[model samples]
Target: MVNKLVFLILSTVILVGNQSFAQKKITLKEAFKDKFLIGVAVNRSQINQSNQEETKLITSQFNALTAENDMKWMYIHPKEDTFNFEQADKLVELAKANDMFVVGHTLVWHSQLAPWVFKTDKGDTINNAELTSRLKKHISTIVEKYKGKIDAWDVVNEALAEDGSYRKSPFYTIGGESFIENAFRFAHTADPEAELYYNDYNLINAEKRDGAIRIINNLKSKNIKIDGVGIQAHWSLEEPTIEEIETAIKMYSETGVKVMFTELDISVLPSPWNSPTADVSVSFENNPTMNPYPNGLPDSVQTQLAKRYAAIFELFNKHADKIGRVTFWGLHDGLSWKNNFPIRGRTDYTLLFDRAMEPKKAFNAVIDTVND
Candidate 1:
């Protein structure tokens, strides 16, 4: 009788916790409504409304949504002459329907590009002149299509490497250091009112932070428009001390540009490399040491996750004036890119919601910080 009674109580508690998050009157978007936008990156399933619960979470909790892949160059502009708007249109339509802010991610990227992006229509090597023309056309077309809709554009992304060096992407190789300047110029020409950001990860590293600073300042000096800096906070629990994040935010804000915590997620698994890069391409084979906690997140790890998110949100609240947006890379643990990233088939609990779509302690902790 005691065992059955205890079982009933435990079951009731689980049911209550799961329902409470969605049942609550307020949302993350509503909590931070006046301060800055709360956002999440959306996959196609979410945009298509196939993932109904995720869609509900997005509509309820977030005021902004950036596409996880649709807006990227290859996906939207696959062929040399074929600029596909089907997938991207769905995202914009959903955002508009939900009254959410839209951030058009990635006008240019080193990865995930069709060969036509780097080659001419006639299969010729894209010279500097050809590349510049292509850039102008591509930027103009995309920015114009979603001009009044997408609130911001990641005008350029991950253009710098670690150790403060410019990444030798095809753009840089062909257009020289001047490519970034010209890209921003093209984007501004297409949509003068929409905000433009230079987005990248690992800004907490001093060298990378300073490099981003130099890039933004140089744009401003040249009279090119740069509105914000995106720190893709694809972080771990322990590394990047709060001091470093705060310092980076303060530094970026000093550039007279809004600071954004873009692609924010805290990975609990052991990293394959010690000092990780922002590169999403880096991956390794799964092993027990790296894939610990595959079955489920331990309670201790869950607490640490809560504490970590709370601290970061506290810092964000402290500097709310300088921040423009804070976007999680994904909506929930089951959908997080961290799971397949750096090792496919590795289970990862790197988001505020668990695989069951229930809010973790981290979600409640963030809400408490805002309320406090």
Candidate 2:
């Protein structure tokens, strides 16, 4: 009798455990429902799985995908004389198989560019004319190659500094400020159907916000096909209130172009470039440890980070009609570029999923925040 009772109790617990587990795990399909879309930036390793396990998981959830590396000049043309498309080819294939839209990361940017493009045989800088020809050729080839495959193109990225001045990007030195116009023109010629966008960071500020408006409006006046503006909301634990971001979005929409929140992530750490001694703890309200957990991101800081992301999505949902898409920079915190830049060699938790592929609170918050 005792043995039977014990066995019965254990069986009951097993069934209850299974039911609880099912409730906690939400698939991408269920999470995404029918509201605003959610997407992730993908690297080669994720798509190259032999069983295509990782690729399927992501594609099933996201209707869109962005190439994290291949579109960059470094990977496309590592050597001046050669062009490589092996990785890019694989990515496009995966997107096709999964019936997902692809976003070509960039046509021109300051970072991750090939050294050979800017330097000559004698080590002197190349002139604007030569650079212009190369820029046109590069844009034409890539845009033409993936003409219909990519849904949209970030023609020029982060072209303005925070203060609203034209950022001193390498493109400026090589093709003059007019490089922006030339890039969009060439991309349009190569693939008129694909949407062209002027992507940048810190547009939340009024100064940068106004400057972006002027540029896009000017392009519209000249009949240059600028389809949208990409606001890279790489916010910190503090700063960039919901109203500020919403205003920026509304400002861009006035130019008759779509607004997208691309490259979204919130880093909870010492701001202003990670001075280890800085008092970042003051930024958070709930959890105020000066030096928190892993990578010095305090638990209190994580709570504040979660709230911040939730607020942004609330704004996104409010403006879903005007907002084109919302994209997270990476699949997991382990793969985020934040771990390296602005504050080199620091472990930063700025992604939705933790290093172990487990969904963080931010992930759930976003799902709950989004309505089907």
Candidate 3:
């Protein structure tokens, strides 16, 4: 009798353990379902993976993948003389292990770039020739290192402000407008097989839309080797209507460049910035509290956001032939840039998962749309 009781207890424990494991397990096959590409952004800390849990979550959901680190110039080479390839190397290994289509986030960008890149050893502005050589060397070394591992590269990023003009990023001031074209060309030369891209934000607005079209036209006219355009859909709950986003997509597609929703997230909140400090004095230029976060996204708001995503995704599915990949800015809401930018100090939920890592209503809603 005693032996039998012990056996029963052990059986129960095993059963409960199995159930717990099953709850966390999601295969890449399950995540992809019928979609061509569904991706999530990951951080370096997440890659210290002990199990296949995170990998499974990513691969099951996405076919086309991107590293938010390796592609960025600052991440690849933080210091002038030191080029740290550790983080990016791990991402590549993970992608290869999961059979995922990896994309390099960016080769050149105004944001997240090293400040020293604009200056020389003598602390003066580097000449155009030196700048061009550094650009080529950086692109060639990194892209060539990844070679066949990465599928696409966002060679340039966020070069345009909200208006229909250049943001006048450090790269632009140092290398001129031709810098954009040169980045793409240099990246291509590094890995002739990789598809090169230009990424930007606020594309849904009319002014930015025109700017993107003009840039694409400029590249085409110059016979530049541009492949795709990455629309950084850093959207708010209100403002950019579904029609507006679709319109932007159509407009860019008209340029014969494939579009990818690169950095996507909808800020579902009590107010735009979700901060009490944003009462009124927040200036648009420097104040992070300019936009107030909503009180809290109620169930209805969540559903509406899901519907918007579904509609946009439906557009993507319809035009999958012209689309390359759809990537969420961050995998989990806790790590999103929205947590700190635009609003200085605000605790808000604006991603597919909440802080607890559980899929919110929008997650199921998106899945349902994909299934439908």
Candidate 4:
């Protein structure tokens, strides 16, 4: 019966390999229970509860939900007066049903904005006074409607340039730097209990970090209630070193404001400009060389990704007291913006979960870091 014994042995080995790192009783939310909440961005599909498999993972591993696009200006308020709360309401209800914290993505941003936001009925650019009034009314309507339901909000997003200079966004050009604090003021008026945050990418860069801190300090000086800062931790494998991130964490912590590692994802693809900034407008022509791992991530690159996540989690654990939450940009790599961002049709494996909703090695590495 030598063949029988070999079959038994082979079956045992295969089973063990598959079960070793598969989903278990252990979950990311449970792992980081002692620290901050684990969060993920939910698309409209997730909001409708259509994807049971994805929802199962999200419910088990995450305790915070950020609407991927439902709460944006373009979707929430397509017209100046028309406010649609259909999907937005569903998102909040989903979070409440799951007993998860809810965060409103953004109140003001330059991108994905309606043309009417910057123009009048006559197709003319609105003046500063009219624009400020519009901003106040918009923030008030959304924030007040979900006052107690939404716990936090990205009060203002992407306001600082990478070089620490104020970007010439429409808000800045019309209302000037005063728009930043004014937005915070309007949100506070809507819901004083709601925690407000300013979120942006490239936060690890020293210049941008300083600019953010200056804004936060100025808000506090004006007696405006600014609660936290969201550092969109969209990083790559090699750059920003662990040291740079650690330094930023400490500096933001020093501001006496909670630091959130928002939009946390590590890209495994080649950089288009070798920059750390996250600009959806930036794009390039398709190049297979940029997407070398079209078939899939090699085992070696997977290990590197795992190692990178583990290291970052280790740092987060060290500063768990200062941090508020760590959120993945999306649930799975297949749905990650990186897959279609910068260049369309690129197979980028840049998230903790694979295309099949299976937890990749990086997931385990992060769990291990918090467990330790």
Q: Output the number of the lDDT-best candidate.
A: 4
The count of backbone overlaps in candidate 3 is 17
Error of 1 at 37 (Å): 0.7
Which lDDT tens digits does candidate 1 get at residues 69-113? 888988888886789998889999998998999999999888888
RMSD for all candidates, in order, please. 6.0, 6.9, 7.9, 5.0
lDDT of 3 by residue, 174-224 (tens): 777888888888987888888888888777778877988888899899888
Candidate 1 vs. true structure, TM-score: 0.92
Q: Mark the regions of model 4 whose C-alpha exceeds 4 Å error after superposition.
A: 1-24
Better of 1 and 4 by TM-score: 4
Report lDDT (Cα) of residue 34, candidate 1.
72
List the candidates' TM-scores in order. Answer: 0.92, 0.84, 0.82, 0.93
lDDT per prediction?
0.89, 0.76, 0.72, 0.90
lDDT of 2 by residue, 109-180 (tens): 877888888888999988898888888998999899988988899999877766677877767866767888
lDDT (C-alpha) at residue 201 in model 1 = 84
**Candidate 1 local distance difference test against the native:** 0.89
Error of 3 at 365 (Å): 1.4
* Model 4 CA lDDT for position 211: 93
Candidate 4 lDDT by residue in tens digits, 33-95: 899989999999999999899889989889999998889999998999999999989998988
Candidate 2 Cα misplacement greater than 4 A, ranges: 1-35, 50-53, 273-291, 295-302
The regions of model 3 sitting more than 4 angstroms off are: 1-35, 50-53, 270-297
Of 2 and 4, the candidate ahead on lDDT is 4
